[model samples]
Target: MTVEYTDCITLSEETAELAEKELRENEATRRHGLQQVRDWIVKNPRIVHCRDDENFLLRFLRAKKFSAPMAEEALERYLLLRQSWAAAFNNMDCTLPNMKHLIDAGYLFAAPGRDKYGRRWIIARPGVFDPHKFTNEDMCRIHGLVYETLLEDSESQVRGFVHFADGAGVSFPHITLFTPKEAVRIVKNGERTLPMRHKQVYGINVHPSLKYVLDFGLSLISDKIRKRVKIYSSMEEASDEIDTNMLPKEYGGVIPMSEMIEKFKEELMAMRAKLLSHDEMKVRLEMFSEGARVGSVTALKQGSALTCGGRTLDTTLCGSFRKLEVD
Candidate 1:
């Protein structure tokens, strides 16, 4: 009885710390949620065998609004999806030369400050996007850095986030040249894998000519996300959802977008070395005895499943990739 009491006290303390440290949920909810997810994690032999057991489980639980079953299914799909895209994902390095070119092109940046709900805001200006200059794979690497650096905050995980996908500068040529399939892959990757609350997506400054691209992209998202999406024909209308005071001057703020982006560039410049170091750590985990291994990326055609490092995943791939030669 004394030992059981001590165990209970220890569990309570750990749960309290979890609440304070990461989830920001109340202690009781944290304890219950963690236990539920933990048990769910243990039951899934695949999850138990994966290196992502530590963070992925909790991330999916919270992302799924703490439904253990849903989170489990989500985790399984996420693992299977990432494993399939070896060319795109294997040895992903944020500091790659291509990634730096995209950053310098002003493709992606975290708009400084939080939204009214204390949520982080990021604006991805794919308007300046040039297919000849980059590839779907490069965008994926940029997203890796975005999630690792900006969206990794425990608070952002709890409060959720909003993105201003400004496609004002994107022409019909840009859409056609890049291919809608690759576009879907880049957009949907966040939906399928990123571990955070995605509350709102504002399609600001969308050009009328590229409405087809918008329509096609919207078709890929579920009704839940579809309803949360608000498309604005003009920047003024989109401002209602964001605090303009927090945005760059281009979007109506005190500072210029160029200045904010330059500051972000400085931060990026410093991370080049760190991101490079991570490139060497990628491994075909299934070949390793103790390393956690998941199945590979399935082909998009709904054909046979793909296998990597002795693990096989039977899932349909949702996106297509183009083989482009980089300059």
Candidate 2:
């Protein structure tokens, strides 16, 4: 029979006593270590069932596997201490983490040290490491989302009204205008017609109460246009003053209303023109020849009851008109 050989492990009495004494003396440290581990586990509950702690212990053992048994035991204790520290902090709160809170707690510091691989560790405060910081792109996304939500909620307040028609003999629909600048092209059901492009016509007669709402909404979208928009009492009066002739040809301005109808015309010729055009083109042209004085013309039926005074003639003659081609 052959005796089996086995390795023997033994601890000296002095060594055992020293270990017990160290454990007793550092009881607070041990407790703190355990708490840290518990906090980490609480904070990262997903990692509780993971092999993280086991992996860390394995790594430590590989590096010091040939060390004394006591050294290995100390390493294990250190890992458990760190885990306790993390767990203690993790259990404090389940709400979203705040970098400011961590910094205020003095748990983090900008210390310079070597990492596990002897590489320089550029330590930074928790604020720098926080992943939830609002970036420029994030802010833009939030702004766009909010704007869309508001637009959808206020859809009823942004309605449109039709005011003018080009009558160009085209298949296009009559040009409609909205008091507010917001307008969109929509197709009717079962229709294959091309979508129409409608332009905003200024100086439209809007209800006083609606006017305030439109002004506020326009200001929210575009302050420049909102400031420039003007509201008038009547659409016809507004159209009559705005000199379509003064505008560039590209803007649909051609002849001035003042020059369109003759001051004195034979009844026969006036009747013939009206019959040929199927619409009366006569307009009474008012001119203020003297300084800020009222003037009137009754020869043409257009301005029979109207009066013009100080700078009104010029102001009316240079107004811009928006031409909308609706379909």
Candidate 3:
């Protein structure tokens, strides 16, 4: 289930009116009062209920005549409380109020469940909020927390783990609507290089909706892969090709002499189509080799073929005796 930041921050009219009264009295007191309100709401036995309309909470908060700073502070506290609530609900079993209040207001769906111990839980699926309303970074954090919550609460539900393909973006499992930055970190750190093992649990299954969001999020990140990086369609394919030197220097792949020469040629071609003079080419080629004569093309060619350089290149073309103008 997904909850928007705005939805989480919504305040009931009673709470809002109380907050407004505090704001009117004193500025410092108002900020503290708002924080107290958030703490109270989280500690309260009842989940906040909205009467009349779903936006009743939002309206109540808006009606408050707080100074801009106070309003912002209150809003910040409200958001923090909501985040805390989400974290708590995900990690621990707690009595949740009737979700129908949120459903009636059009904020979420009521897909409820129970843990192995028969403790009740509710999944908060998002309502009609615009997807673009939140930044990707924000979505990533939210998804991370949500995933952690689901994992802690329903340990039995996680069925298996899967490796993300090279250049493939993955979201945290459990929640399907947002991409997880942790996924990105795992890939970048080469954690996805090997198959990840997941414990088979009774109730765990990947959410279909989360898969959709992950696919989109992955597309966004994959699009950023440089032309130099090769993206594999699947983990199997990536594994088959990946080697200690599979990644680029930027990613810690040890560039071989052959790859360096090819890169040099590509760069040279971009600079000018004409072939480099024998001496000049030898000098540049030596940059990828050990100590060698700068003026001798024959030595460069022979050295390149001998080393093989951990990369597959057709050195024969550069090795042909006819091409070398041996003095």
lDDT of 2: 0.25
The number of the candidate with the highest TM-score is: 1
Give the distance in Å from residue 38's predicted Cα in candidate 1 to where it truly belongs. 4.8
| Deviation from truth (RMSD, Å), model 3 | 29.9
TM-score of each: 0.68, 0.16, 0.19
Regions of model 2 farther than 4 Å from truth: 1-201, 245-327
Expressed as tens digits, the lDDT of each residue in 278-308 for candidate 3 is: 1111112312322111111121122233232
Find the 10 residues in a row with the least total lDDT in model 2: 189-198
Stretches of candidate 1 exceeding 4 Å from the true structure: 1-24, 35-56, 177-189, 262-327
Clashing pairs in 3: 157-203, 157-204, 176-210
Candidate 1 weakest ten by summed lDDT:
318-327
Span of 10 residues, lowest total lDDT, candidate 3 = 274-283
**Alpha-carbon lDDT, every model:** 0.58, 0.25, 0.29
Question: Per-residue lDDT tens digits of candidate 1, residues 1-327?
Answer: 111121232223443344345544554554566666565444433332443332334567667666555555555545544554555554445456787677777788877667666677777888776777766666566766765565334456666777777777777656665455556655665675556677787778787777776788888777888898888888888777666776778778888887877787665656556544433333333432221222221212223333445565543221111111111
TM-score of candidate 2 relative to the true fold: 0.16
